[model samples]
Target: MNIQTVGVIGAGVMGIGVAQNLAQTDHQVILIDISEDILDKAKYEIRNNIRLQSFFQKSDNRKTPDSILEKIDFSTSYKLLENADFVVENVTEKWDIKKGIYPQLDAICPQHCVFAANTSAIPITRLASLTKRPDQVLGIHFMNPVPMKPMVEMIRGYHTSETTIEIAKQMLSQMGKECVIVNDSPGFVSNRVLMLTINEAVFLLQDQVATAEDVDKIFKGCFGHKMGPLETADLIGLDTILFSIEVLYENFNDSKYRPCPLLKKMVDAGLYGRKNGQGFFVYQ
Candidate 1:
């Protein structure tokens, strides 16, 4: 289906970015957050993402970013989502919370509106089953820093229809993202492999094999990696990194996929990479 209006549930980092991108493409975007405070914060984030792309950077293009920001309609009310042609649910990683929104989305959205989850690792099939229109539900996983990231991982669940998959690709491509299709699995591909590498880096730090900075340096210095695991985990959110590692471990039952204690402690303490001002390096 041709997507003219987009509904975004949750106005967190990922949600706003998704809204911003769609809005830039001139799609009327409804960005919903349950709490007014969270919705307010998301509005701030969307503005920043737009400013950085439009005016802050010397090398960045300005046109599309401003237009994208202009197209968004931020709200705390779920009723605003009714007219959307596509719904991009980007709530927190908790399964129950994500599951709760789908049925509600199903009730409100147009019967043919595409349901796309911006989930990083959860099996889409489980989430899809909760909705009435399972055939149209699919995963459209955008990487972190959505405005800057170029890739969008399109994950198809066990029962995802061919039409849903095609529409997902078309929507993301229309917004200028590189869409790669992957089966519903833990961490899909890039994140799964990257999690292992990051977990190993964490292991080295915990085992006293290297300092966090050096752990990052070794990979960048010798392994041709531009961003090391710890640095990456920080940017990806230590909470997200830990959760992805856990999912990978649980899915594979592999010792190597186990998350580091340091990772857990940081997340538990609420230090989420750049967002928290501390993960590996100080952000501020």
Candidate 2:
């Protein structure tokens, strides 16, 4: 179960982050996506993240931008994915889309290759059910801005074998990341707890408790949180946060997990956070 090459199937933030991290470890990566344009964009995003990390860490002065760029192999063909030691699906959060990928990947990949999803909310058990090799499938969820975030959630599905989970954990830890194993649960651990706190913050905002700036200042000043919920939402994307809350609400049927209306309105208005240059607070 020792991983050598990785195939990342998606070109968005999560997919690119996983690819970049793997690459920085000098592991070969086949970054698959729908089209060239998307892959190009993802490559740029990964480069930008690396550049920022270089400035902030200010330790590794040897790894230049060009050096980091050499680690990825972008491809539009699924053929490149067949030889991957692990294939990580980080596509949009849709059951049918992920379900469709498993059988196809299973048919092509080596029998021993492990399959994992970067799904922030979908249960790993459900995704495992759709695959011919259910035992190989599990959840390896990474937070956004992957290089900076050291935590990774390794979720064990009903069908996922112990061997696969262990291998996944070892690989993540080998990359100098921390791993916390969780039994397949809705929103796993971090999302479940984080969403509740964020929902309350949204409620206060809705009730006019204070301005966004005031809320962030008070939370950081009093509780010692580096970033408040509202500010983090802006950075992560309001739409992304809302989607996680919706998943939680449906799975637990808890009104507390219900997304704030203000969150919805901003999403509806297309204020998707830093990417869109606007959200709870204006960016740029």
Candidate 3:
């Protein structure tokens, strides 16, 4: 099916990026959140991000920020999603919060509307079970800064139909993204390895092995990685990293996935990395 009108759940960092990217592609977007205040904040962020992208990328063919913003309808009502042909959920990674949204989405979205879970560590199959259209539910794990990223991790749940996979691929392609298909698993490929690395990085900081800057420098200078695991954790948000680690630990029953105490402490203090103001390192 041709997906022209898309629904994006959550108005957080990822959701705003997704909605912005879709609008730039000329697709109509309904961005839904729980409150008008959050939606208002999202609108302001998207406008700024679009302007920044234009300045940094210097692309002559890109749409104006005003035109792009016009394509998105930010609302607090789920009823706005009634006509959405596709829905990509980017809510918090906690299972309890996520479980509550799917059933509502199933009731509200059209039968043919595909549900893509843009999650970090949750099992797509488990999320699919909550909806009657298991075959229509899959995972489309877009990386941070969705517009700048060129690739995504497309996860196929146990009952996700091949047709659903094709539709997701088509939509991603429309957004100028390529995807690598992978089977369902907690954390999938990206976070399964990434969260462990970030957790270990936190442990190293906790052990005073090196300062956060030194640790990130070693990864960038010596390992040829663009960003160190600690910096990455900061970019992903400390709270999100902690939650992903907890999910992996519980799912695998592995000690290695246990979240570092320092990570938990920071999150409890409300230093949620770039989103807030501080985490492993402070942001301007």
Candidate 4:
């Protein structure tokens, strides 16, 4: 099915990026959140992001930021999603919050609407089980900066059909992204390893192995990585990193996945990384 109108749940960092990217592709976007205040903040951020992105990438499509923003409808009501052809849910990674959303989305969206869970560590199969249309639910893990990223990690739940996979691929194609399809698992391929690395990085910092700057420098200067694991954790949000690692620990019942105490302390301190201007390293 052709997905022209898309519903985006949550107004957080990932959700705003997804909505912005969809609007740039000329898709009508229904961006839903729990409150008007959050939606209002999301609108402001999307507008700013569009302007900033224009400075970095030149595109043949000359739609101005205002015109792109016009394509998105920010609302607090789930009822507004009734006509959405596709829905990508980017809510918090916690299972309790997500389990409460999928069933509601199933009730509101069209039967053909595919639900894409843009999550970090939660198992797609577990999420799919909450909805009656398990075959239509899959995972589309869009990278941090949705518009700038060229690839996504797509998770195929045990019940997700091939047709659903094709539809997801088609939607990603429209957004100028390619997908690497992988089997459903807690953390999948990317976060399964990434969370461990970030947790270890935190442990290193707690152990005084090196400064955050030097640690990131080694990965960038010596390992040829764009950013070190600590920097990545900061970008992903320290709280988010901690939650993902905890999920992995519980799911695998392993000590290695245990979160560093310092990571937990920082999260408790409300230093959520770039979003809040503080984390492993403070942002300007």
Which candidate's lDDT is highest?
Answer: 3
Local accuracy of candidate 2 as per-residue lDDT tens digits, 1-284: 66888889998877888888888877888999999999999888887888888778877444766776787899898888778898889987766677788877888899889998888788889888877888889998898788778998889999899889887887787677998889998889888888787778888889999888888889899999999888888876787788888888888998888899988888899998887798878878
TM-score of each: 0.92, 0.94, 0.99, 0.98
| Residues 21-43 of candidate 1: C-alpha lDDT, one tens digit per residue | 88877788998887888877877
Residue 243 lDDT in candidate 3: 88
What is every candidate's alpha-carbon RMSD to the true fold? 2.1, 1.6, 0.8, 0.9
Error of 2 at 27 (Å): 0.7
lDDT tens digits, residues 1-284, model 4?
A: 88999999999999999999999998999999999999999999998998898899887876787899899999988998899889999998788889999989999898899999999989999999999999999999999889999999999999999999999999999999999999999999999988988888888899999999998999899989998998888888888788888889889998989899999999999999999999988899
lDDT over C-alpha atoms for residue 15 of model 4 = 98
Residue 155 of model 4 has an lDDT of: 99
lDDT of each: 0.82, 0.84, 0.93, 0.92
Candidate 2: stretches off by over 4 Å: none
Tell me the lDDT of model 3 at 197. Answer: 87
Q: Score candidate 2 by lDDT.
A: 0.84
For model 2, name the residue pairs that clash: none
lDDT tens digits by residue: candidate 3, 64-135: 878999999999889988898999999999999999999999999999899999999999999999999999
Report the CA-based lDDT of candidate 3 relative to the real structure. Answer: 0.93
